[model samples]
Structures are given as C-alpha cells and as structure tokens.
Target: MEAHSASYLRWIVVLLLVSSCIEATSFSKVKHKNAYATMMYVGTPRDYEFYIAVRVLIKSLSALNVEADLVVIASIDVPHRWTQALEQEDGAKVVRVENLDNPYKHQNNFDRRFKLSLNKLYAWSLVDYDRVVMLDADNLFLQKTDELFQCGQFCAVFINPCVFHTGLFVLQPSMEVFKEMVHELENGKENPDGADQGFISGYFPDLLDKPMFHPAPNGTKLNGSYRLPLGYQMDASYYYLKLRWSIPCGPNSVITFPGAPWLKPWYWWSWPVLPLGLHWHEQRRQTLGYFAEMAVMLIQSAIYLGIIAMTRLVRPSLSKLCYRQSDKSINLVHNSLKLVALWCIVAAYVIPFFIIPYTVHPLLGWSLYLLGAFALCSIVINTFLLPMLPVLVLWLGIVGTLMVMAFPWYPDGVVRALAVFGYAFCYAPILWASMVKITAGLQLSLEREAFLPRLGEPWPPSSFKLY
Candidate 1:
C-alpha cells in the first residue's frame, strides 16, 4: 500500500510539471494573421513623470480619434492607479503584465526593460493586432497620425545618424522577430549605442519602407528642423540648433521632448502665446546649443595651442622652455605647425555645413562678414600663417629684459597658460547652456495634461467597465 501511494504521488507531480510547461508554451506562442494596425506604447508605472507623459500622449491620441493600446509592463507591485486615470479617457487599452520580473523597475536604464517588454508584446501577436506602431510614452501626437498605418513592410519616419527613431515605428510583430531581436540585444549584436534606435537600426535593416523626414508641416521654418514629421517624433534638440529642415504634419503630429514650454524659458520667444499644450522645442534647442558649443570650443583650443607653439619658436631665448633648433629652422617649423593647426580648426568647424546661415540677423550682412573675417584671421595667424606676430608683440613688451639677458626670451609658460585659459573660458558658457537645455528639455513634464474635463463631465464615469 505504501509503495502504491508513493507511485501515485510521483505521477501527480509529473502531471503538474507537464501542465506548467503547456501554460508557459501558451504564453510564448502567438497566432499570425493578415495586416491590422494598432499603436503600442511601453513604460514602467514606477516612473511618475513618464507616467504623466504617457497619460498626456493617450489623451492627445484620443482627441484625434486614434485608437491606441498602452502596454505598461512593470513589476506586480506597480500601482494600478494609472489604469483608473487612463480609463477616464476611454481612448486607450491598458494592459498590465503582472507577477513578472520587470527589468525596468528601480533601474533608470531603458535598454533592459524595453527589450523585455517588447519580447512579451511580440509574444501576443496571435491575439493582438497584426501590425504594431511603437511609440514612447513621452510623445504627444499633435495631428492625426493615421498615415503611419499605411506603411508597407516596416515603416518609420527618418531621423539622423541615418537610423530609425524607435520613438515611433511600425512593425509586424512576430515571435521569430521578437526572439531574434532579444537575442541580438542581449549579445550586443544590435544597438551598439544600447538605445532602441540602435537596436532597431541594427536588427531590422530593411524595416522602414517609407521615409518621412520632417517632424512638422512648417518644420523648415523652425530652427534646426531634423525631426521626423510633427506627428511622427519631434525632439527638442533639433529646434535648439536652429537647423530648419523639413517635417511632415497633419492629424498624426507627435511632439516629444523633456521640458514643457512652461518649464523652459528659451522656447518662450517662439512658442505660441496661447500654446495648445506643452512645447518640446525648448529641449531640442538646448541640446543643439550644447553640441555646437562643444565643437566650437574644441576648435578654439586647437587654434590657441598652435598660437602658443608658434610664439615659443619665435622667441626661444625669451621663452621659459625652448626647443633646441636653429632660428631659421624654428621659424619654418613654427609657420608649418601654425598653418596645419589653423587648417585643422577650420576643417573641424566648417565641414558639416548648415543649410541656413548662423548669423544673428541677415540684415547685418556686413557685420557678419566682418566677424567671419576676424575669426578667419584669428585662426590663420594663431595656427599657421604669421608665427612672428605674437613673438613681435612679446618682444616689444620685454625690450629691457631681453637687452639685459642678451638673449631672445620666450614666455612659453605664460603663452601656454593663456591659450588653455582662453579655450576653456570661451567655450565653457556655451557648453553649460547647451547641457542645461538638453537636460531641461529631456525632463518628463513637457507633455500636455491627459485628463482635463470638457465642461461638465464627471471625473470618471460612474458606470465605467473594465476588461
């Protein structure tokens, strides 16, 4: 009797194990179907700021009558409070993946969480829609974005680094593709930058069939317009630099950035006085300024270093430190070094030519011309052209000292120190400002509020239903 009872228990355990496997398999496998479009947005509920942005985004979509599903893949503990908030709009389908090890919880990194959520969502391909349009929670749809559904194969609007912005893209979610993407992401075979864009760019090389370059209808008029259509993805950094390119706009406009117009001061000048919602342009402008300033400072440092080198060569005896060489050889070396340095500086700053001129005002053409000339002269003289000019000035200052020493005195230390200081001081403010703009712009409160009642509507419908 004891042996029989033990055998029965073992059989029961085996049965239970088999049942578990079937349940797991059911979750993993998905049914396939013909083309159908659905919007997908993913985020962790723990991040309150991101949650706010997500709500606003959903509200914007609802206003445009676009049907979207928001997938909040988080830990079991993440509050269901957002569901109540989202349901108020009746414009979004909120799916909370429960009792799972949410990679996004606690960790500020988006890579791991994004991968995990994407994997799970792809697994639902059988029950979910055929095509999935992935959007970031922080994205605000300004116009009707239905055109995105018309995309064939995989479709995404174009942005730079020549990679598709993962902020918004269309894909036929499949188990095979999901598995492939997760494997690639884990192995670093995809997304060297470890961002969504990098992952998509590396994984689905032939995904985006159509390329909508601009982010807004009048994006060309906006400063630094490299965004992917107004209804697609609008990053604030593009606006900060004032590059003014093309952007698509309509009902599908998407405005995305860190700080809203109310929070950012830089964009106050350009944003509409009675702004409809949060404006993301401020953040883009801040980012552009930061990068441009860094580039400028790097070029300036090269020029200053070249200047110091030339000065030391000219007055070796007067200089605190000296290179052992004949006067003629030193002069030749100085001139060559200066020229090379100057050329390098110019090349670094000028190669990536902007379509729009960077002058403060086109009417001040002569002033702009003079400024350019001055800058050019500074570069040429300091880097390559006139090595003796600085030495001549130094010589004039130390005539008495030089006469006493009976040698050419070179103030190498002073020159080098000045060069370093000049470079740092000149570029520091620009870099700081740029950083501020980018950081501020990327902050979460920039999107419009998702829940503002029309007129006399109740806070949440008294007879609302949940599925």
Candidate 2:
C-alpha cells in the first residue's frame, strides 16, 4: 500500500509541474494576440493632460512587465510631434483619425457636456489583434492584469448594483460593430450617461443581467461574465466611501478615477476642497498604516474649526471677558481677499505634494500646478492677506534666489520662485489665526449695528488648555 501511495504522489507532482509550464506557454501566446488601447481627442490643441496620464500608464505597464501591444487612437487636432514622441519614446501605435463630427445628446449634464464620445469608436479600426482591452487614460494599474485578456471579448466590472463602469473593459475589435454603432449614433440613439460608456452599454444592454463564460489564456475555460472582485478597476473615489473597513486585499489590478473632471488626479487644487486625497496615501501604504493621512486631514479640519471658533464664538466672548471694543471700519473687499489668499496658500503647498507620485514627466504638471497655485495665491495675497510678513519673506527669498542665480549652474528664476513662494507659503497658521482674529473683531463692530444678540460665549481657550 505504501509503495502505491508513493507512486501516486510522484505522479501528482509531475502533473502539477506540467500544468504550470502549459499555463505559462499559453499566457505567452495570449500576449502576442492581445493589445491594450486608449483614445485621445484634441479638437483645439494638444491635450497634455491625456498625454501625462497615458505616459504613466505606459510606464506602469513597463514596470509590471505586461506583454501586450500598446495602441493609441487620436483625433486630427492632436499634433504628430506628440504622437511621434508617444510612439518612439513610449512604444505605442498612435493612429490619428480625422476629427470626427459627432452630434449626439442625452438631454442630461454628462451627455451634453463633452463632444468627444464618438472618437473612441476608432479602437475598432485596429482589426489586426484577436482581442483588445480599452483602458481610460485616467487609470493606473497596480498589478499585472494579463489575466483580463483571458476573459471574453465583453468583460467589464459591475460598478454599481446593475451598472458597469466603462472606464475599463475587454472587447474584440470589429469594424462591423463599430460601423453599426456609428450608424446608431447618427440615427439618434440616446445614451443616458452621455459618454462612450453610455453608448457602449447601449450595444450590450443585457450585459448586467447575464454572466458570460469564455476561454482563458491557459487554454482553460472560465467565467468571463461581468466580474466585480474589487480587484479590478477600483474607482479612486471609492476609497473615500465612509465604510467601517476597506483594507486592500487580494489582487487590486487597476485603480480608476471615475471622479468629476475637477477631481482628476492631475487636478491637485481640488484636494483641499475634498479630503478624498487622504485616501491616496492610504491606498499606497502597507499594514494599513493606521490611517495616518486621515489624522492629517483631521488636523486640517480642526484648524478650519479654530478659524470658525475665532470668527463666531470667541469674538462674542470678548465683551464678557473685559475686552475694550472700539469702532474700526474696514474695507470688505480687502478682508475678502485676505480670506481668499488664506485658502489659496493651502492649495499652493497641497498641490505640489499631489504630483510627487508621478516623478517622471512631472515637470509640466508640477510647474503648472505651482504656477496656478501661486497665481491664485498672489491674486489673493496682493489683493488682501496684508503681505506684511510675506513680502519680508519674499525679499529674503529673493536674496537667496539671487545668490542661486549668481551661480551659473542653478536653474531658472521660475524654479527659484517656487523655493521663495514655498517658504512664504509656510506662514499659513500664523496668518490664518491673525486674520481670523482681525476679521472677527471687524465682524463684531459690524454686528452691533445689526442689533443681533451675541452668540453665547464659550469658556476662554486658555482655561481649557491642560498644562
């Protein structure tokens, strides 16, 4: 019995090793047949936003060592210089289609918003491959997803209950289907969501109701249905959902940004408005890290509350706390600009950190984010915030910058300005506290004129402090 058992175990081990080799070979063949594609529509000029995103996708693909052909479809407005760079530098087959004239409306905000949905159909023009995966430019793949190519030509994630997010999908390129879709659009077919997603779902209306089965690259049949393992096409905003527990596990292949246009990862200014950016650091961390980013956000929130407290609660208490009140009329516009500069200063610093993850090709995004941040900051600061300290900081910065400029080896004045503005921006907490106190005093002077009762005064702040 022992001899037979030993022989059986040996046979099982041999079969497992043979199966592994067979699967590896099958994956290689799938790579040769499958391709990854993205679409770019530029009606006015070059779209550096999409280019930046596409570059990251290519870099990530290289990092993951994915074995699929990368393809890009662009509109005529996009310059060949950029396309050639994409092809030569990033190894992409960029096909420029004539600027398509698409006129379709869904009678909603999203559908009536953008005029470029029809450009995505160009993916079907590439019939050279047996299968293709369409990934949005705003997506980042965290792990190898060569397995997705194994799914059927119509595999996608069931994003919400019955709806599928079209940000990521697998489909076989067919010119015939593309033509039919164009015909339908020309014939006034309506898409409720108003984008390629809505239009494509119109083609597979019953996709949400049914589960599909197809062959994997390993020559084994598997379920190709709308799969939602939370491991693929994870919406970045989904991390912000207030749930008890959402620790990352298993294989999270793609991180999708299905957020508003302003919330795109490239738009760093939006981070200050929505704390959703906190989850970004959390997602990239191991061991859960105890929500360290959220702690920072909480501090940010507390600072915001402290401002409100000074403006609302503390101002009223000054009367009861033996504070002398005198009339001091102030310019409303000046104070308003002070508020603007106060907020803009935060955005200026916060924006730079957002682009740190994309070290490559970060120059454009960083400079743009900083310029925009500073332009807005300057407008607000020069307008208000009383550049008293900032101007001094700036002068010292100018001295330092001039020294750097004296050295022929240093970068341009613009780079030096970031360093100056960076130090100048650091005076937020002091400025914010002083601004709130000053503004609150002015507010109280105005409140007496309105004949409104004083808001109940909370205890003095110093009394509450534990020494």
Candidate 3:
C-alpha cells in the first residue's frame, strides 16, 4: 500500500509539471485595462533613430493624458538604458520579449528594414490589456485618441482605399489567436511582403468588407472586427497638398508618416519641407529635449573652428621647384598636381557631410557641415592657392538638390526622382565650367610664378619632408 501510494504521488507530480509547461506556452488574459502598444527591436541601422522616436511618441502620449497605458513591446536585446528611460523618464510600461523569428527572411524581395518587424505579433500575447492600439513609432499624435479602445477585436484604417494600413490598428488580445498565429508561422504561412503588415493583412483578408466602427454612446466595448475612419490614422502626405489638415470624421488624432523612410518626422531635415515634421520636433522638445546631441554638436563646432584658425595662422608653403619652360614631362606633372588639388577640394566638401551625426536637428547638421566643409576647403585654397568658386558651387549644388528632393508638389516618387535627375543634368555643365575656370586660374598662377622664389626672398625655416 505504501509503494502504491508513492507511485500515485509521482504520477501526479508529472501531470502537474506537464500542465505548467502547457500554460506557459500560451498567454492567459488577466488585466482588464486598455493600452497603447508599440514594438522596438535591434539589428536595424536606424535603431537609435527609432529609439528616440519611440521615446518621443510615448512622452507625447503621456503629455496628452491619454486614458490608456503606454506599453512598449521591447525585444530582450534592447539596451537596459533605453528601456529604463522609457519606464522611468517617460512613464511607459515595457514588456520584454524575444525577437520573433521571421520565417520569410530567406525569400527574395524581403526588405531588411522589416527584419524584426514581425515582433509586433507579440501584441496578441499581451493579455494584460483588454484592448491595445498597436502603433508605429513614426506616428505623430495631434490629439488624444483614447477612443481607439472602443474599437473591436480587429480594426485598422484603409489609407490605400482597399488595403488597411498596419501602421496603426486596434486589436483585442487573445491567447488562442496568438497561439494559432504562432502555429501558422511555424507552418510557413504565405507572407507576400515578408513583414507583419503582409502577415496580418493575410490573416484578416475580409476586413475591407467590414462595417465602419461607431462606438456606442455608453462606452460599451466593441466585439466584432470593423473598419476605423481615416481621421484616426491620417496619412502625413495629405497635409502636403494644402499645408493644412481637413480630414472629416472622428477627431483628427494621429498622423502617420507612411512615405520614405528618410522623410520620417523625427529627422530634422524633414521639416520646413514637410512642415508636419516640425510638429514632431515640437513634441520631442516638449518631452525628450535635444540636450544629448547638443554637446556633440558644440564639440564638433569648436574642433572645426580650431582647424580653421590653425590653417589660417600657419600658411604652410610648398617646396620651390626649378623647371624648363618647354619641358613636356614638367607640364604633365603640373597638370597632374592641379587635378589632385581639385579632387582634394571636392573631398573636403563631401567628407564632412558624412562625419556629422546623422539625426541632429537639420539646422545644426547643415550648419556644421557647411563650417567643416569651409574649413577643409580653406586648407586646399591656402596650400594650393586654388580659387574657391568651385567649392562654393558644389556647396550650392548640394543645397539645390535638397530643395528639389524636398519639393512637396511631386505627384509621386518617380516624378521626384526625375526632377532630381533633371536638376543634376542642368547643373552638371555649370559645375564643369567652374572646374575648367578653376584649372585655368591655377595654371595661370603656376606659369606666372614659374616655381621660382621672388627676388631676394629667403627660404622657409621649417618644411615637411615629403619623401
């Protein structure tokens, strides 16, 4: 009887362990509150940029005093410093999750930008919230959109008329659905675009036929899937036409940047051209101030100023050479040296543009680039006595290209590309003309001097060895 009782207890223990393992595999709904959710993961080139954007987003939501919890579905690899800032500084709740394996990553045409985007499917496992509005970090909130909680089990906007945008959507968390979705992923579900957008769209292919959602007057939660109005997820492109928003429906709440990745509102250069980008910057200023990048900018500015000063103070002279007037070998060497000097000037302008921080405010970034370029170009000018017109023309050309690309009236990206191409075509001849004039001036200066010191001129006391 003792042995039989011991055996029974062992079997019971085994059953308990199996039950716990099963429970751990699927989420169980517990909390009753609603939440505003967004996901963050690493491995993207724009990780820091997105990190800043997410913080600004959460802070803006808090500033609006929304009635729902701000939740970030952060991957486990996201730095503790970032997650801590979101939790403590920004008053956001972070749910750490593993990077969701993207089964479609091996397929051709898959965008690497969306490599970790499938991590968004973890929203369904967030059973602590009765409803969650999954958001993209690029969303700029114009007003509180707490009413999104009233949306049903699945709801999204049809920004493209037929297809609903996944940038922002409402969903009710369900463990069974989450489990089934994982099962589908494991079974190699058809994800045409190889991202969450395609997978979710495929999962709910019938949402386009659903009725428009109208929340009941008494705040009763919606049950079935429905379509959200365009006002909730207004595309940022719409405001470019008139530079004003006129979306008629629910409160014009959130504006999403569904255009080019570089034109996202968080990018400082995206403003003044996109106008709406300023709104995002304003939100950032009100919440996550620019103090962090300011120090780096100040340091860079001082370094550039020092370089300019040193280059001006020490007028480093080149070695004086003797040459016959009709020597073809000397003439070839002279032409080669002139070409090298011109290339150096071009490099001076370009190298600094890439060296400056990528996401600094546009004004600061452009200012630093210009100053650094000028400093570098001054070195070439002072050393080789080359004319500055060629360098100035190149700088002006860069500014022109930016303006043409940022012009808001282009009907589509293809037209924008063509406009840029046309601008380049028009500018090339002028640039060539400047280069020719610069080379001519340089040649004239060299021939007139004939590499000979002026009468009674003393040799420099210090010289760099160039062996």
lDDT of 2: 0.54
- The TM-scores of all predictions, comma-separated, are 0.39, 0.56, 0.82
Candidate 2 segments exceeding 4 Å error: 1-31, 44-46, 105-113, 212-228, 242-250, 270-433, 436-467
- Residue-level lDDT tens digits of model 2 in 224-246: 35554555777665554431125
lDDT values, one for every candidate: 0.40, 0.54, 0.80
lDDT of 2 at 218: 72
Q: Write the per-residue lDDT of candidate 3 for residues 159-270, one digit (tens) a residue.
A: 9987899999999988678767766776679998999999999999999999998878888888899999999899988876555677987778889999999888887667
How much is 426 displaced in model 1, in angstroms? Answer: 17
Which pairs, if any, clash in model 3?
A: none
Cα-lDDT of candidate 3 = 0.80
| Candidate 1 residue-wise lDDT, 192-282, digit = tens | 5444555556665753444444334432222211224544666554433332223436333565554442332122222222122223322
Indicate whether candidate 1 or candidate 2 has the larger TM-score.
Answer: 2
